[model samples]
Target: MLEREELKLYNRQIILPELGLAGQEKLKVARVLMIGAGGLGCPVLQYLVAAGVGHVGIVDADVIDISNLHRQILYSIADVGKPKAETAKQKLEWLNPFVELTAYEERLNTENAARLINLYDLIIDGSDNFTTRYLVNDTCVALNKPLVFGSIFKFEGQVSVFNYQDGPNYRDVFPEPPPENEVPNCDETGVIGVLPGIIGTYMANEAIKIICDIGETLSGKLFSMNALDNSMNVYKITKQRQAISAPVAANLAASPDREISMETLSNWLGETPDEICIIDVRETYEFDDYNIGGLNIPLYELQESVDIIPVDKKLVFICQTGQRSKIALQWTESHLKNEKYSLKNGIKHNL
Candidate 1:
């Protein structure tokens, strides 16, 4: 279950009809293992944590370098010489306190690959090398875990979801790793800074979709995007299809049952005022000027006195823009699990 603060933090996304509370709940329960804390891993980690993935493990043994500050946006010059995994965890904590981040300041190797991958529901290959990529992929396949794969070159990048619901996998797409001599090093060949950012965001998006189990994911398809030419392509990856379990129903619409309008609130007050708890998440100044007679609890201070917000009645959070109210509902006691809602659009015009 998502914490009260998480509801407020992810209010913008939680209101999404496609994602709704159910999809956000799915994201909150997902445990993801990310291999590498380099170019692609940087953005992947940032967004995954921000999106409230329950637990994330970062695997990287490398330390920051002054040169890495460009594409690896998570690090700064002050972070140079610090281990990437630990540094990322430290930085990401400021991004989302609700996410549980673990740093393995060690490389993912054959010895620990299976053990580490076993702990996560999903795997993402953001490593810069083929050896690490192949290892992560094979381990994911063996463990029957879906993998979100991404790679960046100078101006081009590729993204794909492998072994998703028994669909195509990395080995099925690459067949064999390129010869070591033939592999181009980002250090030697040099990569454009913006290239990884574009690719990394795509990888993060794919991870979210995978976690929420929504949309036509890149499963059985490889997406290639080029920055220089401004081009994109989707290539079919051939694999013997396996029977896929029908995914849980997604894109649940925001039901009126979960949201309240001014008219509805007024009716509820007239009929059963004893059965509802209205919380005005606006400031004291705003509540003093006008309110529908609810406890005045500013959104910022909601976490402190959240326990006082009664849970037995139908809870309705209200604010001027409706955004804060959505966040207010999220800040309510998670353990209560009662009927909770946010005023739709706010009581500003209705008043």
Candidate 2:
């Protein structure tokens, strides 16, 4: 039941023939727990609160960083250094007093995953890492809760509904988490600030649809969009005979000295450009699509002392994941004795 004030606050949306009063009421009582109060979480919380979602929970251990101002619209310079979950709740409470907000200022980890997940009627995975993504999906499957998932890479974003009414869970679409460094994150690759807003709102819309039991949700569909090209796609998701739980890839567990961190590599590139050579082993198409300034030498075509190996420049092999780059190094091991390494976790990061 909505208060007289809530009815007025949401009158515009309430009047929609498809939504009406019944839908508004459903929103006023829906309990939603969103993971990650970063880029994606900001817009989602704002829309859900303003739209009168009655009970909302936020879980984020990260404090506001100055870099977050671009996409985390709910925060400002003044809010920097504050806990995201708490700051969001305090501000969102003012957005709609009719909605109850709770903040858990902590990361969602294995120990606390099940407990926190069980508290909500639905889950919106605003998390940015592959580990958390799979953990959230598995827990949702265990607890029988619907999960609305969204992720943003450099210029593209993906959204889908998992474990909805026994629909294909996340595992069915991505049965395994990509290697830790296979896909670089926004921090490493960068995203246009407005991209998250566009994608996050789509996620919130999915949540509203679920809570109100209206419209066809992306229960068994994957929605992907490229902000750079302004293209969108919706692909049907097929469930596997049994959901396969994927282990977090240990592709980065190689010897410490044998691998390089992106930060160190970036610092080296900036300070001593002549000292480092980043050899991207991904295919020509992949490297052409995106690369962080590196030579494009397809792994399949790699050869010893390939095209006069520079003796002065330290070699760093890179690929989608660190695994293929390792192969590239082995192929060149005998002929090239220059200090070489496989980029720790590859060029792009999933998280």
- Give the Cα lDDT of each candidate: 0.81, 0.82
Cα lDDT tens digits, model 1, 88-153, are 999999999888999999988645776788889999999988867866765665457899999988
What TM-score would each prediction reach against the true structure?
0.68, 0.69
lDDT of 2: 0.82
Clashes of 2: 5
- Which residues of candidate 1, in runs, are more than 4 Å off? 240-351
Q: Residues 1-351, candidate 2, lDDT per residue (tens digit)?
A: 778888899999999999999999889878999999999999999999999999999999999999999889999999999999999999999888888999999888655776788789999999989878967886776557799999998889999999988789887887557756596887788988998899999999999999988999999999999999999999999976343221222121235687788888888889999898888877677788789877887654565327755777899988876755765564456557788888877876722
Each model's Cα RMSD: 23.7, 13.1
Q: Ten-residue segment with the worst summed lDDT in candidate 2?
A: 244-253
